[model samples]
Target chain A: MRNIKLTIEYDGKRYLGWQRLGDSEKTIQGKIESVIEQMTNEKIEIIGSGRTDAGAHAKGQAANFKTNSEMARNEMLAFFNRYLPGDIVVKKVEEMPERFHARYNVKGKQYSYYVWNDPIPTAFERYHSFYFPQTLDMDKMTAACEKLIGKHDFAGFSALKKTKKSTTRTIDDISIEREGSMLHFTFVGDGFLHKMVRILMGTILEIGAGKLELIVIDEIFETKVRENAGETVPAHGLFLDEVYY
Target chain B: MRNIKLTIEYDGKRYLGWQRLGDSEKTIQGKIESVIEQMTNEKIEIIGSGRTDAGAHAKGQAANFKTNSEMARNEMLAFFNRYLPGDIVVKKVEEMPERFHARYNVKGKQYSYYVWNDPIPTAFERYHSFYFPQTLDMDKMTAACEKLIGKHDFAGFSALKKTKKSTTRTIDDISIEREGSMLHFTFVGDGFLHKMVRILMGTILEIGAGKLELIVIDEIFETKVRENAGETVPAHGLFLDEVYY
Candidate 1:
């Protein structure tokens, strides 16, 4: 059996997300698997690095599947592009080692969220950005980002109530920058919990707006309470930028 | 009567461009007019600089309408933003001279066309750019662009079959530049004929691909035959970048 690693990019505006739901073709994984089934003529199960929430985009999402078909890499790539919807694209496909697994071998990930800071709504970026439509105090937001960088239990920042598994994760870096009328927040970490990035963005926005004090992040970190963080931001602004192995 | 000039921006993916058609609410002009009518409680006519084809976008389109309402500029701006679709925005509004017409007083205009040059389709920019998977020779395209500049009769470059008016037009400047995997073509001229920008892009693309000779532009200018130039590119890739008065 040959293991094929696929680099996927998708606009999740109309998709449920990266994971396959039973008997439903509305998800990104389901769409790709359907195309692969037609190409390989076999029922194959593909493993994704992780799942992104509904309406969350991905640029360099990784996945792997075992197929007995001997199709070349370029041929498979072309076939996938031809069959897949315009919003979802298989950027690259490569033959992986027999022991290689997409989900089990994931090392790190990077996510970026865009907040449109203009008072007037942006015509072109209506679908991709969170239209905050308010002035954001970047200095304070940047300070909050600095405080967020480190290994910590992010349970307070996630959507989960209580976790059986450890919520301790290492955030290698966090950067807040402005591009024109948009505020960009980039996070690189070992792993992220459910709705963790969105919650973090919400808290930062709240801090920027002076609705919450800068110390709220520290309070949430110490208390490990979900309600301490700000409300969860929309999923549309978030992007799974890169997945590393 | 106070004439309010509006600088408009819209994503033309859904609308029928910037012109109003019989009872159709899909046009950008129609949407603005309806909002203006509601604001003033009077049926008013709004004039645009020119008509952009259906599915064509605009960033700096200019329009003007007469109204007796003494609404402040900021108030009007806020009102327009609140009423207009999320894909459309009134960027600026200013009181203009009574005689200043949006169409008649136009001095120069600028339009831009975006071509995605990568093999893999862009996830974010899919709606904004034309996905041209084929390789484009920028040097050859630039050479073609250089030949296109100057005062010339652009009848052959337009989509119009017959015209009583003068087809003589002056192309002030043309710039072809690359930003990452996207090729941007900007054209500045006193005025453009129907589909003239799109036709020019198509011819330049052909020249870049070695499908047409560099001298075809000169040939089209000399012949003044509509069939001499290349095909018109899609409207989705074209944008009315700026309207100068």
Candidate 2:
């Protein structure tokens, strides 16, 4: 069976997350799978590189599926885009080796959280950014971010209710930068636990607001206690930027 | 009476137009007026610098109203923003002289039209830009734009059903530029008749697509007949960039 790789972009505001759930078909995977079944007249299971939470957007999500249809790559892309909703788009389609798996073959993933720090509220960017009217200390936030880089047990930063096999994850890079009225936090890691990015962003925001110190982050990581971590920021500000293999 | 000036921004996608319409309270002015009446408990009238058509967005639309609420400028700005819809924003509020009228004191206006000249359909910017898959002749479009600059009786380019007192208008500047996959056309003018910018954009797009010659634009303007003009483009891609006095 030929493996078809698809690059996806979606505005995840109205979704119930990427994974399929119950009889409710209001999911990104469910929508795509239903469209594929309709076109190919066959039931196929598509695997995604990662699952982004509800209200979290994506720009370059990767997925793979096996299909026997002899449709051209361009035609498949066009068909997927035509059938999908306006918020979701299949950017590219390519045929890969039979052993190619979207999840197993992933080398790393990058996520970004956006913060609108301007005093005045932004109407157009309300959905894409977390609005914080309070003044932030950028130096303190950057110091906290630097401590997050490299391999570490991210159990304290992730949600306590996660059922992952392990909480230890290797973070390749973490950087915080400000652009005009927006602050962007980018994290590249081998894998992320449930709500890990949002929780980390919340911790950084607390540090920036002078509520939590940089040493507090290290103490939480060392203690491996989820309760010691900062609150989980809302999902609307977080985005799955890219999945790399 | 002190004239309260408001610098406004709106998405305009859901509005009928800037002016109030019969039975339909979907106009931008109507929405603002309703909110103002609720805040001040008075029947307030707001005069806009120009009437933008339905689906035409604005970045710096100017308006003025007479209110004796004794509210500070910042309070007024904050109160309106809190009550207005997410798509509309009052950027700034200022106390002006009694003689300052939004409609009568306008010296010039700037409008911009965006065209997405990409083969792939865009999801996020679909509502804000016109999609033109075919390649355009930028040189030809630039030449045609140059001809549109300067004073002229734009009766041929204006909408046929308009009931304006004068069709003569002076365009101070016209610029057509391409950035990446988007083409932007900006017009600075003393005044514009109904659908003048849209009709001009349509004509330029036709010329860029090799359907018409550059000299044909001059011919249409010289004819002073509405039949000589091209079709009016959709209002979604057009924006009232700013109004100047």
Q: List DockQ for all candidates.
A: 0.78, 0.52
- How many backbone clashes does every candidate have? 0, 0
Expressed as tens digits, the lDDT of each residue in B148-244 for candidate 2 is 9998888889875655577889999989878878888999999998899999998889888988778777787777776666678899999898999
Question: What is the fnat score of candidate 1?
Answer: 0.70
Task: Tell me the tens digit of each residue's lDDT in model 1 across A1-245.
Answer: 99999999999999998899985488999999999999999998899999999999998999999999998999999899899988999999999999999998999999999999987789998768899987778889889998999999999999987769999899999897788888888999999999999999999999999999999888989999889899999999999989999
Q: What is the lDDT of candidate 1?
A: 0.91
TM-score of each: 0.98, 0.94
B83-132 in candidate 1: lDDT tens per residue? 88888999999989889999999999999999998878887777778888
Error of 2 at A92 (Å): 0.5
Once superposed on the true structure, which residue ranges of model 1 sit more than 4 Å away at CA?
none
Candidate 1 CAPRI classification by DockQ: medium
